[model samples]
Target: MKIRSLAAPFRSSSRNNVLFLSTVFLFMAYATDAQHSAKGDMATEQKIHALISEMTLPEKVSLLHGNSKFNVSGIKRLGIPEWALSDGPHGVRAEVNRHDWAYAGWTNDFATCFPPGTALAATWNPALAYKQGLVLGEEARFRKKDILLGPGVNIIRSPLCGRNFEYISEDPLLVSKMAVAYIKALQSKDVAASVKHWLANNQEEHRDSIDVTMSERALREIYLPAFKASVMEGGAYTVMAAYNRFRGEWCSENNYLNREILRKEFGFKGVLMTDWSAAHTTVKAALTGLDLEMGTDKKDYNEWYFADPLIKAVEEGKVPMSVVDEKVANVLRVMFNTKIFDEKRREQGRMNTPEHQQAAYNAAAEAAVLLQNNGNLLPLHFDKIQSIAVIGDNATRKHCSGGLSSEVKALYEITPLQALQQKFGARVKINYARGYEKQSTFREGNNSGQSGSLNVNWKLIDEAVAVARESDVVLIFGGLNHDFDTESADKQNMDLPYGQEILIQEVAKANPKTVVVIIAGSPVQLAGIVHRVPAIVWSWFGGMEAGNAVVDVLSGKINPSGKLPFTLPVSLAQSPAHALGNFPGSDLKVNYEEDILVGYRWFDTKKIQPQFPFGYGLSYTNFSISQFSTDKTGYGKNETIQAKFTIRNTGSVYGAEVVQLYVSDPLCSVLRPEKELKAFQKIFLKPGETKTVEMPVKVADLAFYDESKKAWNTEAGDYILQLGNSSRTIFQKVKISVK
Candidate 1:
């Protein structure tokens, strides 16, 4: 099982010797299979095994760690090429130095910046997720990158998680559906998608060492589904281990999570690499199924845990040689899957093409959720408006290059102010005012130079009010920037920072026709002005075309169809983790006291109302659902419950609606959420158009993880199918029996 060393004459003494061995291996490989077949092909696996058999121990060890900052070492004599990786789930990140974190200053590294994960999840359209992934894959390949470390599927456990913008949702099913689509599309372009932060790295506070504890039920039901689907369904090529600990063990070396769950249960055959400097041990990590140790702060490459230390461990019998072989096998498998050996045949992806920009625009335009519009104040008519007041700091701030790892060097970013000026400057007199000032700047792992002054600047507020009084319509773009919603640090609280509440309230008071657009990636406190503002829109960090997407929605060119992926609680106290007093925990340990009830589950189960429920969104037009019914009144556990409904666009405009199907088990042996989203479909319609939608829910999917039985159990009982546009707005309910 151990890798055999080269013969004495064939060693690396001179270039001629190395070239002789490379020619011999290449001839052997071609003789075995002239056409290197695809992955899972018997010929391909045989070629990989043949190559591994000839690789020396030193060569195998080199492949387990980085030779450069973002590259895995390759066997030069054997003609194996190095593997290149990049940061970004939404776009291909700009190139950095070969040995450090500094930018490489390459002009050709610019990429198409698409909307972030939260925005993609809000769309509830897996098709858009696939489209975004296609663009990301093309750009990653254009940069000659083998892997794109993205489509972070970690559940949004809390609203304050610094990286919530990079995650999909609070619910596992929703996360799984979106992740599978993103992964499949990315890999289709021959670029591997590294589904990341494996195993419950939910919160960023104390992430490097905080130990997370949760029930097996919670782990199986609320956390593991998305990762499972990514492997089994998406056929993901790689997984990035988290920086935290799960159940008191570092995720990179945790045997239970990596060996038992990911490798054995889900049958993942891909490489499991560390999340930057996440590796801590050598033998245990390798034996426990870790294939690659990507990044560590060690100045010398040989000092890395998976480099010299790993080879020494194998030589001293501290680690088995079979484990090293296994790791190499995984790496080789990815190389073959991505066609590393056949570069000419691989995809020659183009970067920042018009098609790529269109995909980015599609995601941004479809992901803006209109949270409130009391008197139809939105879809602003340009003819009726004489003077328009645009206020806030976010209106002018560019968001394409702020966050640390996810930053993209976009060709150009269209700010809201710039977009508005380009679209409507001649039609209307648009006056601008910086109603609030940013009090902090984000610097990767540190939050330095943050101002402590929370007091409202009366001077700025008075000036904004005066501008609002003179304008016929005021659009206040107020929300968080990268200073608050970023990686490495969670928000201190859910409050609107930098006197934004006072500024928004004063501006709204001066002009009753005020529309507030919250431009942020994560949830923020909206109770301050939810009632005061006549219109409210939740626009996420909309990548390079942020302003264009928001303006399109505001002008009725594109209807707002995006929904809330996670529950927006009225206050921090109403959240499950906070309500149980166990967030970010004490003494470096956190408990999942809320158990399986993470987001809307706890709110609905405890009868606590959220400000906006999961899947909640408003449209410029109206949608009506009727004739909701199930195929049968009873079915076996294996049968599919075909739920059919009729939806119509009742307004005088084109729009889309997400039809959500939730299941309820009123009398389960164990406590289940009041309702769990089993299936959903986003449907588009023209004015007065009716479409019949059929959503199928399998009876086995309704099963809860019965901890007592150590398995999922679908009890034979009466279940209710509730169909609606959102989680809380059920229009019809039909009862079905599972036997």
Candidate 2:
């Protein structure tokens, strides 16, 4: 939080320094009219209009096209500077040194990687999301970035999504709540928060070309809610159109999605940028509300879809001049809002600070979901344990530099081995072994370089078992890495890859007190082995301080409050999306056959039990719910029903609990999910302390998106409001009639 002065230099010339030549042409084009806007003009409507008057048709058109891979041209005549963008949402992407899409290899570009969206969602706390965003925003501001294209909230429609690690959750409410907090915190720094892959972009395979044919009702209910909340509630001013096509049109140019749903309905007030090389045409893209055309070609910037093509159309009267003006105006508005055009530099050098690291650790600690604790084996006593064994592929793997474009150049990352050694110090003995690995591993931690084949092969399973037998307890860190869960390739199956499952089974036999810690973004079918393991921890691909956070929870320094963001089905076939068909669709098309019944809704509706239900996570201690009551039994469309429930820490330990509130429509005109999450709150309580938490359910939220009427409508019926910790664990219920 310190400020220093530095000369405001032009953007680093390494990337788009070629534009310096164009600046001369711009200087000669309107040298007389060229002037900066009045200092501190506040960028009102009048100022935007006045600035637009200075630009020629060609200048306006140039501003709409991709000048570089990640930016649009800026009008020098109007003193509008080009806005720069960073990729990969978890952190500010390492600054690119070359003009081509490559990292700068500079020390300054090494950002502190925070936990991914899936980890954040697991915390079941929006406050933690806010903290993550605040630190992320501060770093982005220091990097001089105008927009942070982040906090991807795409529903986990398929756990097979290679990029599911980047997205938040499988439910709309969980996704929306977390997305809103991140957006609010980032934008508060005056940096535009652009939520990406706007619609039906769940899976990464064939993402750029696959056409997702889903119903409008499904779109409005499951997929659209997160994007809608980010825009309509969180006040996000930027959005990145998804690569996939929805219905028949690409999301970048889908009129109903971009214009009708996003802009007209949700009242989004910013620019819509297409995913890299996503758009195909000028007229369809332009008329359908695609504001800024970026990355039409990944390698070069010459073959643009909007620049020269849009200019000719405007002059030929094929496209109206007004359409061009609106796009230009929106870009300028964002630039002004982000302080890109401001003369005075705000601040600098906020990267990799202590606060950033602390925030990363705090968020990571809260996100570790203790899936199972059999016979009370966890919270290992430091004095009683003389020797420990840590074994697995993820023990040494680097998660931040994985398969996604958001590959982070983390300044420092602590491995599980390093963290345990630091925690135990000279007090306890720790043994380590790479239980299993693959020869052609592409994940960052396995190979010496970024993304490529490596000469790695499975090793040391016997050595791991020997170490486990010698130790008091075996801590097996095994699960998917970037290879099993990353972009461009959807996983073949949900089983733990690389023979880690066999390693875990062997280690469990060697040591009865085997604690299995699975490092992954989503679930790996644990129905078979979970029963055998003494304890199980679902540790996500945590951030830079992941190692320390993991140790803190294991040693009783912190209590695990994280919950399942999605259901852990007993088998892949048990999931409604798969059981109902259309998931992982064939012939280049995927259908969302299970309209509104996604995740827990599917399990609850189908009466099929899952291995671990959504919102289910274990604390070190137990809690009891009592004194459940509601404010009223009847409600109107605009009224809000307040429900109060008491939660007491019944066990002899302090812990946090997530109170999940779900609304059920017993009778309705159309089919609905068995229950839909309305709202939730995360609260901490001392041992023997009882706290009454009141949650409000807005009647408007009760309405379902009626595809026939093309609106969200409510019905007059008796609604059941249930209070519980997990989706299925209903502690209390009350009935209320909607009038």
Query: TM-score: which candidate is best?
Result: 1
Q: Runs in model 2 with CA error above 4 Å?
A: 1-43, 298-300, 345-349, 443-459
Task: For candidate 2, report its TM-score.
Answer: 0.91
Displacement of the residue 556 alpha carbon in candidate 1, Å: 0.8
What global local distance difference test value does model 1 have?
A: 0.89
Best by lDDT: 1
lDDT of 1 by residue, 258-372 (tens): 9999999999888999999999999888888899988798989999999999999999999999899988998898888888898594678899899998889899999999999
Instruction: Report the lDDT tens digits of candidate 2 across residue range 491-536.
Output: 6667777666777778888898999888888767887688789899
Candidates in order have lDDT scores of 0.89, 0.82
Cα shift from native, residue 576, model 1 (Å): 0.9
Q: What's every prediction's RMSD, in angstroms?
A: 11.2, 11.4
Off by over 4 Å in 1: 1-40, 447-453
